[model samples]
Structures are given as structure tokens and as C-alpha cells.
Target: MTDESAAPVSSGRRGRSGGGADARRAARTATTITQAGFIRRAIKPYEPFTDEQLQLIEDNAEIVLQETGIDFYEDEEAVQMWKDAGATVTQGNEPRRFRLRFPKGLVRSLIKTAPREYVQHARNPANNVTIGGNNTVFAPVYGPPFIRNLDEGRRYATIEDFRNFAKLVYMLPSLHHAGGTLCEPVDVPVPKRHLDMIYSHIKYNDKPFMSSVTSGERAADSVAMCELLFGKDFVDQNCVMTSLINANSPMVWDGVMLGALKVLARANQACVISPFIVAGAMSPVSTVGTLTQLLAEASVGIAFTQLCRPGAPVVFGTFAASMSMQSGAPTFGTPEPAFVTFGAAQLARRMGVPFRSGGGLCGSKIPDAQAAYESANTLWPTLLSGVNFCLHAAGWLEGGLASGYEKLIMDADQLTMFQKFAEGVDFSENGQAMDAIREVGPGSHYLGSAHTQANFQTAFWRSSLADNNSFEQWQDEGSKDIVVRANAKWKQMLRDYEAPALDPGIDQSLQDFIAQRKAVLPDSMS
Candidate 1:
């Protein structure tokens, strides 16, 4: 997230000395991407529920755990852990599915070992991000199987597309983490895709990144890769990666997610115990009803991580959305989900863990007005709710089905605005500007005042995407829309991107490890 791009600021490649226009273009593109610090909220979080109301929700969640129970599917070890922890277990109708009913205080007791906040270290120390407390880390769109651009429409993503998005995230200052699974690289063999995805994140960006949770084996591969990049000792003591482990909604934790969670917890890595809740389908339709289910579900997952390894880092993550009653399609940026996020954030703080939710979410099929409006709505709640880690912060489109090229640029531009807003109102002597008031007293303008001259360049946040020029000037400049401007911005970023430095010996070791793994593993398409 910091501007420690392996290369120095003045070392960017320049154009050949041929023409004045070419030299000017090189100079314009040569400026280094500036440093961007992760946001730490200065304003208080917007907690929607009173203490008594929160207690009611908490009590209801315990009721659900005691009465309805949660299911652990196809993981005998997980079931055994819960049974050992004093939870009542019953065999489910389906094979390998067991219902776990915990006593009121058991889950809370197990979660006591989790750290309230932890630093996820990047290769460059400057890029390290704090997760939890008042901090907010912005990561790019996750789990989009398709990539969309104006020129090509939408298509199943390839590894090339994955690398392209990684480079974009590396260059975009607003994105604080090199997100996992930027887009599903469908072209690669399904079994081996995680390797490529993990490699792409490390090679393209030095910032903190996520691990592969598609399977336990893949998660191990991610750890091994990190060991090669960062020494094994460093990997063992520090959190090099933070992965997503989601629960199956309606009170179920499947084998795949449980497996990945166990690996990460045992390795001392961080994982977000998120429930993929789509209200009306996955959980209850009512806002309060959904909050109860979310708390109950996330509690079980977070407790299970502690069961795996005490003092492991975990996040109380919720991916909540509303389903359209008529069409059954999921909706984003709705009031109901915002309410759920606010309630869930308070619950996370009460449980003494970091919260993760919201993003530039939208159900719109393209980067049009609907996309902008929905993304804006979701982003506002995300910041105000005190979300500690925001996945899908940029580049999401079409209800999380695609990663839009233009949308990422536009959303990143807005992230800068959020960073400025998070600083709250500055109250310094310079900020007060008493001298400016005196200099421009009574009807006189201050644009040319002494204080104005001193602070003119830093007075306001500027948009890199929005055009505020005169109509005549806009017409003369071709009157491009934001999307068009964003498209051009991404292209220029990729062209200017320089890969972060990697030690040759470590890089070779990683290559050898990957080659050995690929050689032994079958080329199974699945």
C-alpha cells in the first residue's frame, strides 16, 4: 500500500530522445505512484443498536446456538473439537454432518484467545497494515470469475487477466492489500490455479495479500510459497497472509472451508470467519433476524479457529445482501444490508475481534450510473460502520460476478476521498486560518490571500477521474466520460508498472518449489 515499489522514484523508464511530444509524455507518466497509508478512522463508529438492543441480539444468537445448533459437515476433526469443548452433538440426517449445540459461554470462552488486532506484514515493512481497532484496509475485488472491459465485454478470466489486475492493484495507491483471487483464473487447470494466483500477488505487489482457501492443500501451498519468499522463521512468527474462510449459510461449515481454516490457524496465519449471507435465501429476511444468525454462525467459526490453535488471528466477517423477492437475485447497496452491517460491526467489537464488511458493491451489469450509485451507498456504510478490512473495495461489478476494468479505477479514486474524510476536521493553527479571515474580512475574497497562497495546493481533495473543466474546453478535449477516462488510466498504469524487487536466490527457490509441486500433482481439471 506504500510507495515502496522495489524500484526507486527516479529510476522509471523514459522514452527515447526523439521528439518533444514523446519526451513530455514520458515525463508525465514518470512520476512515481505516491504513498497511501491505510485509513484509521478519527470519527466514532455509527452503532445503530442501543446496549439493551445489542444484548437482545446477543441473547437470541445464543438461543440459536443452543436450540437450532450449527452443522459441521465432513470434518470429523472439527466435530471432535466441538465435542471436546463441551458442546452437545447429534448426528444429522446427511452423512458426515453433525449438529453442534454449544452451551451459552463455551463459544465465548474459546474465542477469548484471539487477538483483538494484529499487523499483517508485507514484504516491504512500509506496506504493513494493522487490522482491527480504528484501522481500515482496502483490498480489491475478490472471487470474480469474469473480467470486463469496454473493448472485450465479459469473458472467463485467464492467468494473464489475473496478472493484469495484480499489477493494477500494485500501482493504484488507494488499495492497501494485494487481494487474493483478484479474478478466478479459469483458463488455468482448477487444481493448479491457486499456485498461479498466489505467485501473481507476490511477484506483482509487495503489500500484504491473502491466501488460497479453495482447499487445504492449496492453503498449504500458499504457506510454503511464503516460506520461500520470507524465511520460514519469519513466516512462523509473523502473519504473512490473511485468507477468507466462509461458512455455508443457514448454520453449516463445510469440509473445504474448515480444512483451509485449520491449516491457516495451525500455521499462525489470519483468516476471516465470514458467513456468505444472502438474506431471505441464506438466512432470515428481517434485518434483526439476519443479525442473530450472522452472530451465531460467525461465533462458531471463530471459536473453531481458537480450537485449532489458540491466539490465532481472526476477523468477524459478514457478506450480507438482500434477495429480490420477485426474481430471487441478490441485491447490493440496500438499506437492509446496511443495517445488518452496522449491527454486525457492533457485535464484532463486543466479541473483541476485528470486523470485515462492505465494499464498492453493486448489482449493476456495467460501470454506469447504477454502478456508481450503489457502490457509493455501500462504501458510505462501510466507512461509518468501522469495518477494519474491506474486501471488494474496488473493481467489483455485476453483483460480484465480474471485475470491471473501469470500475476499479473509479472506485480507487473515491478511496482517496475516503482517506481524506477519515482524517476528520483539522484543527491546527494553519487549518484555523485566522490570518486569512482577517485578510479577507467583510465581502472580500480569500483566493489570493497570504494563507490561501500557503495552502492552495493542499486545501482540498482532488479527483483524478472527474473532469471539472468548462463546456467549451470539454468539447475541445473530446468530452470523455469517467469510464473512458478510467479505461485510459488503467492502460497507462500497466504500461508504467515496474515489478517489485525480489531476491534472485529466493525467487529461484520459489520457482523450484512450484515446479516440483506441479510435477507431482496431477493435471486434474477440477
Candidate 2:
């Protein structure tokens, strides 16, 4: 898109010309102090498990692999690997099943090279987003098979649903990344679903992108599709298109997901190995117990990536939600989840890798009192405590199993607040407001002064929620709730929405490809 507003900063060129010398110096200085402070406040230093414990877990993982097995892949190489690893490989016309072996060494290696802090590439190099630094990116919540259906794998997902959610994402200024595949429609062919989602992303927004690990083969195809649409340099120069790989924690790796990691490595795409360790489900009941399970799982995933491709981009994706035994479901927006978010951030720091967690996601069924309190209370602490990236920023209600347009807008506001908070004021001589204060006098207003007028835009956060109107005017306006205001704002943005103008021929190429794929599907399906 020819957006003058999105152009790279001239200062950035100078900074790079110095080969990031200034950045390196700043990073080193900040790291040293932060590390020292972290040590003082950390709940416990990261300690490796005893050899006996490690052996037991490994043996148990093997047992689980043999008993419960993972599904997908009919490739010969995969079949052979499964056999070599002593997994029972079953070949079939449909999806195949295979056992997985947990390699401790591979797990350790992924952890070692995983970067603690790094910038993800965007199609526009300038659009790169950093994680594990002062910057934190927020994206929409993902995975609702049906927008409102309570049943799993029963309701079919439609293209209209995808487009509606994409439109919502486009309007959210605080959502810096697009969380791919918010819902998987059963009606859409599995092979084409990712492509359909990407088409929506390209048509709707020009931000960082992500993908779901539907399968290893699909992961490879997804990366290929992105390169075909974007460019070969897309992964290196543009925002990161990260693949999400969920590990069966307490157990090191799931074979299907591990295969996807290999595919991502071959493509040189960055990925977030997010292990959703539900306390009392995949992990122990205690917070420490859960943290340890997450660490072990993350370390293994990180190690695998580096082993296959050294320096391969990866983040320690930790989403630790506690399970309510009463409901037997993962609880979102609770104190335990918030605690895990903070602890995970600290843990990722110790391991020197980026961390990912939830945001604005509450188990609340609606965007009401419960939703507001849950989102604010959980997100504020997470952002302040130094989380690098928030994966589920918007469109979540009912514990992240549903998406609501109004809720997405409210979440966007929350994200904006967090961004403002992260940008703590610089108190250097130039930043001090002493001169402006002196000029205004104690009783006089600074509202009309040159200094006030000049700096007001950058000096404070103007809320989309709080009323700055006079009390009399506010009372006359009916005092609508924040949700009502947000809904109105969302509709306005949609009316004014403009698709980014891509380089000549890029959009056409993408459209043509989609058209070709559509032709292959049944007429009714198309």
C-alpha cells in the first residue's frame, strides 16, 4: 500500500547504517539492569529436573504415545520415521495414526538458541514488531469452530463468518497482528481453508500475520502460499507469519506438531511453540507445578527447532490457563490465569526467549460487568509485568470460545491503554515540563499556551472511553455505556475502511490463484 503514514522513519536508516550499534548498546545496558532486578523478584531460579524425574517423565511420555497416538500425514518419510522411533505406524486411505517419541536432547537445544528478545519480520521491514522488549503486540483471540455454537465439531463454519471477523480485526487499531483461523469452517475443504483466511487478511489489513498448525503438510503449504502471494523476502523483510504449535505438555512433543515445526524450519518462518498447559489437566494443580511443565515442554519445542535449523526463529509460547474441576474446562480471566501470565513472562526472560500469553479474554459469557473487570484486571497486570506479545486481544467472550464485535472494540481500547503505559515518559531535560508550568502560573490554564498546544497530542492518552466533555453536555448526551460507544466506532470504521493498495500485480496474482483453486472445488462448494 502507498501509505505515506506507514513509511519508514529516516532516523531508522541512520540507526541501521551504524549496524545497530546504538541499539546494541541500549539493549546491553537495559538487559543488565533488568536481569539483576528479575533475580531479586523471581519466585524461583530455573532449575533442571533430577535425572530420575527426567527419566520418569520420558518413560511416561513414551507410554502415552503408545496408548493414545496422534493423527495426520500419509507421507512415506513420516511413516518410516514413526517406525524407526518404535511408534506403531498405521497406513490408511484416510488420515494415518502414529506414535511419537519425546527426545530430551532435542528439547534442550530448541531452548538454548531461542532468542529472548527479537523483532518479527513484516512485508514492510518497518512494520516489524518486537517481542521480549518494551514493545508488546496484541492480536485477536483464535479458535472458535462456530461463532456461537456451543457444540464442538457439530456446527459448520461459513466464509461469511470469516469475513465478518476479519472486518472487525481491520477496524481495531490496537490489534497489531492478525490471529489466523479464528474459526475453522467444516464446509470449507481443509486444504483451502488457510488460503481463504489469508485472502481475508490481505484484503482487510496490512499488519503482522500468523497461522494455525492444522497439520504439518498444511503448515508447509501455508508458508508457500504466503510467499507466493507476498514474495520470497516476505519472511525476512515483512511482519512475521508465525505458526502456532501446541505441545502436549508434561509430554514433550506431539508428532504432528513436530512435523509442522520441521516444515516451518525449511521455510525459515518464525513460529510460536505455544503449549496450552491447563492446570489439573495437562499439568499439576499448583502454579509452580504448571510452570515447570510449561518450561519443560517449551524447552523441548525450542530445542527441536534449533536442531533442525540452527537460529530458526521461535518464541516460548506459554498460555497457561487453569482448569476448573467443577466445569472441567480451561478458565480465562481469573487470578490463576493472570498469575500464570506474569510467571510465564518471567520464565521466558530467564530462558532468553520471547513469551506469548492471552489478553482481554475472560470466561464471561457477554460483554458486561464481568467481561470488563476480567479483561482489565488480567491485561493490565500482564502488560505492566512485561509480557512480550498478547495472542488473544479481541473478539473473545465466554472464555475464548466465542467472538463478539462489540467486545473486540473494547479489547482494542484496552490494548491502546497498555501501549500508552508501556511508553513511559522520558524525564530528560528536554522532556521536563518546568518551563511550560512556569509560563502558565498556578491558577491559570495551560490549555491555550503554545507549549500545551504543541505537546498535548503526544503528552497524554486521549481515551476512547472516558468522557472529556463538560458535565452538562455529558448528561445531555444520554451517558451511553463504553460498549455502545465502541459499537458505534466499529461501524464507522467499517464504512470508512480502505484496503491497502498493494504493489502492481500482487493483488491480481493472489486473486487469480484463489480463482484457480476455487474452480477445482465443486460448483456448489465454490
Candidate 3:
């Protein structure tokens, strides 16, 4: 995660007197909360692996576990815990690395401890979402160093930019979650930025958001803040936060990530065990080979979560993009990656866990033809592959080096189309409209029919930015490209955004918590 958004741009709301510092402040506090994000109901999912192949992969994964084993580096208790759970654990050739060899069925049984599905609660109860089962939840991009837009060109992200993104995520009805590390705020110190980031999520958006994974302390901060906002009793009893913990490819789970996992799991929160793979560099180049590694890595990571606290909600995530051999840069939204994602989802479903896919990933340098083409390609397959949790759902650009303002709006518009399609067609009697068909008769227009008139608004999705006018009319309206329109769209959203209503007392408590943490932790330049 690298970048952050810019300062809140000019919005439609202005103070009573006119444009000035005080007016800007008044406009910033405009309070409006829309309904929680909509979910994608069941779309018949595509199964890439047949029963025979699925069984083969499972058997192969077991052998891989028996042979290569898994390294639980820097966590001695974890190694002994694995031994206690009936797995063969031994110290690695190097320091602090312990390799675990699971019994034939031990790994699978451990994964079974995870629930089939669970709820991820938001500060606003309305934005709470279900992960797994029949729901498809969309979350925004995570982790980038740079921010890009029409006005700024390219620059480092700051806290102001970060807050602006949270506000936008709150205001935009199309996005499901506010997401984590929407972009890295380099301006903030590394050890302390997480505090600012979590505060931004709490203050700007009432939607569900992710916690930082920089360390166990950072993760604890996430939990402490939640306690202040939602109360300790509620936090302990409910899964109020979900965070991402990426596994080092080739079957290694590092210490920092494991620490965060421990904190989140013991708190009864959720974590997505994602294997960060770029085929040929991190894993074998072949899609099948890459998926095998993805599965093996996810298996052990999920098992660790169960060790932390059995029955902790967990998601099996796959990020199997490829790397360009010539430049060593990552490639996204390509066929190899798609195949890996499809196969991974099949495996996760086989294990009965919620599955995640990198949402709308693309390698395009700009939000141009390449970006749209690649993003659309990725989104369609991700939806069809039965992805339960979609991260990087919108605004991912330049191989995740930066987050784009226009790209977020464009990807969101495309998401609307996919969301509609994922809901599939209705089969009810009224939906079938046999009476309307009979009444209309042969060759008659349905446009003026009773059924059409009654269901017009709800029947079809209306695109916010699509230009559907006739050629002459569109020309008369001034021909515009997708870029120009997307730029205008995002800016207008920022302008119109109002902070969702947050209770003053709870808000103050959160502020005090952050201040106390900062005072003790002093700025570490690392």
C-alpha cells in the first residue's frame, strides 16, 4: 500500500456567506448518511476443477505439507502448539524458523474449525455485510505510496488525502466497505500512521473497514479504538473488525503478520489469509503450480488462526498475478492470474471457507484503454468465480503503486453492471410476466405496457455516467471522453459528501484514545 488521496476538492456545498476558510469548514461538516451498501446476490458460480481434479489437488496439497512442511518463523509457541495439535514440528536449519509437518488429515481438520460464513459489522449497523454464502462484498483498494489526479499530477499522500478518501467511501453508495490503506500516507510516520488511518476510517466513514497489520501493537490499537467506539463488551462478543494478513509466498508466514493474526483472532475478529504470489518469482509460473502453492500457504495460515482461537472467522485469499520477466514488474488481470483465481475459489469452497480475489486489478500506468480493458476482464471473472470478499474493488492502478481518483469512479460504474448481473434474473410469476406477454400480443411494443410502466424504475439499472443519447444529441451536448467524465464525477462526489453522523461522546473517546497512544509511543521514524 503506497498512496493517499488529495485535500477535499471544491464541492457543491458552500457556506451561507460565500467561499472562505470558515465556509470550507462548514461545508466539510455537512452531515448526510445514505443507506448501507448493496450486496451481490447469488450468480451461478463457475467451477474450474471437477471432482476428480479437486480431489487430486487436495491430495497433492497434503503431500506438499508432508514433504516441504511449513515454516512458522519467530513464533516458538506456535511450533510447540503445532506439535501439541499432533503435527510433527522441528527447528529449521536457520534461527527462529520451525517447519511443521501435518498428519495426513490434520491441516484439513484445523481449517474446518473456521465458520462457513460470518458477519463483518460496521459502525453504522446499516453497512454491516455478510462474507461468504450468497453475498458478494466490495472493498476499495489497499496500500499504495503515491496519489494521482488531474490537478495534483503525481505526489505523496498526506492525512488530508486519506480523510478525503474515507469521506468519499462513505458518500459513494456503490462501494460496500471503506477499506484499509486506501493509500499509504508517507507524510505520517510509519509506526504512527496506522493511528491516523484508523481514525480517518472512524471519523469519515460509517462503513466496515480493515485494521492495520504493521505489528501486534498496531493491531491492538485497532482493537482498542473499536472498544472506545463500540465498547469492550460488544467488541469481545462481536466480530467488529476484519483485517488482511498476507503470507510470504513459498509457504512462509512471517512474525509480524502472525502477531497481528494472533491479536485479531484472540479478539474474535476476522482475518483474510492471502498468499501474495506473482507467478515465476514467488511461485511456479504455471497456473496450476501457482494455485497449489496458494492452497498450501492458505491452509497453514488458516490453521494458525484456529490455533490462536478455534472458530475464528477466516477468509482464504489468492493474489496470483504474474511478473514480467524483462522488467520484473507485476502483471494483473491476465489469463494466468484469472485461471489461478478461479481454481483458488474452487479450492476455498471445497474447504468451506469464505474466498477473496484481488478486485479489479490492472497494470495500466494510467486510467486509459488498458486499464478499463484489464479491469473489466478481472471483475467479470472474479464475480463468476464466486468471490465472497472482493478487495481492491475499485481505484487500483499502476500495479498498485498508486490509487487513481478517476479509476475508482470508473471501476465503481463497472461494478454496478456486474452487481446487476450477479443478482441474475428473476423467476417469479410477475418476473416472468406471462400476463403482460399475453396482453401485449404479437409484435406489440412492451414500452407502453402495464408491466413495463409498473417496474420501469426497479426493473433496469440506470448508469450514473453512461451517455446514451443519440449521436446528434450527444454531439450537441458536447462530446466528452470517459476520462473527462470520470474526473468530473469523482470531484462532484467529494464536493457533495457530508460526514456520516457519529456520536459526539464516542468521537471524543476515540480522539482521546489516539492522543494517549501517540503521547506514549512518540514518533519513530522507521
Candidate 4:
């Protein structure tokens, strides 16, 4: 199938040229962001666990929390809060360590105050995403230290790369959230980079975004920046930001994460209480064992958020991956992890909270076949498992050590497909197409029929990065693979990036705040 609306390809040119009226028109049209809404899933989620099985997991998780209590290391405030909440707190073997065990159903009762669903308001109201119920929000890759592309093989990510990614994600209509820490800007000082990352999200994109979670001070700084942009009153009353707070696996809630959670929760910002589990390493090797541990860890983290402030929004998140028994390297897109995601979603729903897990996760070092297959495997389960907020939905590569430019484009292209798929079948009057069938009786063909002409343009989803032309047309137009096409596509997107309008006063205030913070905060390379 060919689109007549598409600009005519010049056989003489290898790649699209930056000249000609038709070419310029097409470029402008293509670069314009499509008005895609957040996915409200029409299909039912895939639930694999029986009621008995789910109860068993919950029972085991409560036992883990009660018997083998979680250690809150180096946070007296957190320990005191637990003690105040009726939990049994005991002195730990090490200094600044405290173990707190909840009675049966205590964690569950505490988390009951969290909202089942809530809106994360974007700078543009139209871009606001609802997390919970049947909605699914997609965000780009987060927390990669290095960047990779066809041109630049692999290198430490810089602020420049971080901003470029922000621009790309903003342009891609499929992605709903401007993810936090798209990549670590190693070029900037470690202490000061969070300011730049937070600023990039506010300056480059208008979508809902995450704030810093490195420390309580940085988290407070994030809330302050939001107050500058969205007003302190509004920030205190509404959910404007959603941040990631991972649990140190093997049942540990370290001070760093607990402190960040407290800051965000008190400010009414959403927090994803995710457990970072690598099966057989941080968790048990068996799927059931891993699920039990994930529930226990997530329970404590989510409950802690409610303790900070009742009714603060929190997601029941789990990041579980299987590890190679021989090499001890983490694996992704495996069946066991998929099962964990499926089970965890069920568990989250039972606990009355939004679920967060799954992404375009893989262990591949490059955007090759391994990356494509592994990413697809993970993404399929993510949608089916009813993931509410999907981070790392695009641009993941090298086991999440590096972010791939081509891979981001490729993953986002697939995300659009997923969005379409989540809509399910139309089944409307037009979908039946009885008129078109009668007009093209005896299988003559509907290509020229009135109904076909009217609906053909919107009927099928078109891929921006895929080449579906015949071999002759493909070869004539420079037989480029998906990776090469993706490379060119991202460069073109950056070239056409247009920053969303921000109030001059607010922008200046943000700049001043960053300047003041940098002046006071000591710079560190670590």
C-alpha cells in the first residue's frame, strides 16, 4: 500500500534532501506532534493467578514482613515513625540500623488511604496522564549512564544528550510522560546535575515529569522548583510530579530511598515504591519466591509513603528480572519475570493501588536483533499485565547501562502500535463496512469504493520508522535498515524541535533558583 499524500521520493537522492517546496511541506507536517491521548485500555488485563494463589502470596508476604522485619538503616526519623505507627522496633546489630516488623495486615491497612487513581497534571493540561484504573502512561528510558548511536558508538552521556532526548520524547506523541534522568549527565558535577535534569524537563517538554530522588535535599529541591513553575499552593494540593523510589532488595529500606519518599509524599507528589530485584541475586530464583519478596518489599515502601502523609499517591511497583545462573548477569524479557509482572499487577489491584512494572527491557549491548526481540517480549506483557505507569518504555540498551538513540525511535514506534492495539476493536457502524462490502460485491475490489476512499487514510496505523516497500523500491531508495532510518529520524526530530512556551517570569525564577543552589551546594564528581 502506498499513500498519495506522501511526498514523491526522488530516485536520484540517497537520503531526503533539505530542498524543494514539497519536501519542506512534508518535513513540517511530519515534525508536527500528533494529538495522541493517554491510553485508556479497552481490553481486560491478563490475570494468571487464582484467588487461592494470590492469597497465599499475600499471606507469605505478611509473614516475611512480620517475622523477618525490614531494616531501616541510618534514619532515626523513619525508625521513630515506624515505632509511632505501632510497629515493633528493635535495635539492630550495626549502628544506625533499626528493624521494624508490622503485625499482620498492618502495612495493607496503612496503604488503604492512597488513591486508587490520580491525575498527574502536565504543564499543558491536555497532556495530563491518569495513573490507575484502566489507563496506561508511557515514559522514555531513565537512569542510563552512557549514550549510544550509529554516529557516536558509545560514550558517557552529557547534558546535551539529556536535552536532545527530552526534545525527542516531547515530539513523540506516543509517550505521555517526560521521564526523569533520561540519562545521567556525567559531564555535569554529580551534586549539580539534578538541577539541570529537572530544568530540562520543564524547559523542553510540557508533559508530566518526574523529579529527583537522589537525596532528601535534592527531592526537596525538586519540589521547590515545581513550586516556582506551578505555584507552592498548587504543588501542595495537587499531584504535579511522580518520582521513583526503589527498595533495596532482600527486604531493605535504606535511608536514601526512605528520605526521598518522605519528601515527595509530604508534598503530595506521587512516588513509585518499586523493589529493584534481580532473581537469584537480590531475590529468590523461583518465580513464586520472587513474587513473595517483591510484595513484602513493595508493601513496606508504599506503607511508608502513607505514613509520611495519608492519601499521598503511590504506585505498587516491582522491577524483577531473572539472572543467569552461570554468569550472574541480569536477564530481561524472560518468562519468569513476565510471570512476576502478571502476578504483581494482580496483587496491586487486590491491594487497591496502581501497578507499575515492565518496559522495553533487555540485556543487549547494542540495538540489534537481541534488543528488538527482548524489548518486544517485555513490552507485550507490560500492556497485558495492565501496567499503569511504564518507565524505560523506550531507548533502553546494554542491560540499561546505555541509552540507544536508534533504539529509542524504534521502541517509540512500537509504543504507538501498542496504543492503537489497546483501543481494541472499533465495532462501530463504520467498522462493520456492510455498505463497502455490498458496493464491492463478488470480491471485485473496494480500493475505489466510496467507503474505502473515506476511511482508508485512518484505517491502518502507519509506521514512521518501518520500510514496507517492495525490494525494487527499497533498493532504489537506498536499501537502508531500520537502525539507519532511526538514526536519521532522531536527527531530523532534533532539528525540528520547538520548545514549548514558558512564562518568562517563571523561567527567570527557575534560573535564579538553580544559580543560587549551585552556588551553595558543593560540587562532587562522584
Largest TM-score belongs to which candidate?
1
lDDT for residue 54 in candidate 1, whole number 0-100: 94
TM-score of each: 0.94, 0.75, 0.91, 0.93
By TM-score, the candidates rank as 1, 4, 3, 2
Model 1, 1-526: lDDT tens digits are 3223422211112211134443345445543456597998898899889999999999999999999999999999999988988999999999999999999889999999999999998876778999999999999999999999988999998888898898899888899999899999888888888888887787677789999998999999999988777777878888989889999998999999999999999999999999999999999999999999999999999999999999999999999799999999999988999999999999999999999999999999899999999999999999999999999999999999999999999999999999888889989999899999988999889889999999989899999899999999988999899999999999888777876655444555666788888888878788
Tens-place lDDT per residue, model 4, 305-414, is: 99999999999998868999999899999999999999999999999999999999999988999999999999999999999999999999988899889999999999
TM-score of 4: 0.93
Error of 3 at 521 (Å): 2.0
lDDT of 3 by residue, 1-526 (tens): 2223222222211111233554356445656566535665666788877889877778888888998888888877778778998989877888999888888888888888899899988876778899998778888889988877766777887777787677777776668888999999988888889999998888777788899998999999999888777778878878878789999888898889998999999998999999999999999988778877788889988988998899999999987689999999988778888888888988888899999985888898788889988888888778889888899989888988888888888888888887888778889998999989998999888999999999998898877777888999888877977777888987887776666545555655667888888888857668
Residue 59: error of model 3 in Å? Answer: 0.9
Q: Enumerate residue pairs that collide in model 1.
A: none
Q: What is the lDDT of candidate 1?
A: 0.89
Write down the lDDT of every candidate, Cα atoms only. Answer: 0.89, 0.62, 0.82, 0.88
Residues 1-526 of candidate 2: C-alpha lDDT, one tens digit per residue: 2222221111121111333554344333321100000101122222233446444544443344445444434445545643553445554445443334444343343457656666665443444577655557777878776564222312445666676666567556677666787666556776677667776666555556776476776676566656655565654344357768888665545567777877886566677878878789888897655665666566556665765566777787877678889989777667776666666666666567777776776778767888888778777656755666777777677776676667777777767766666656668764787878888988899889777887888777777866688878887998776777776776666555544434324444566777776677454432
Model 2 C-alpha lDDT versus the unseen true structure: 0.62
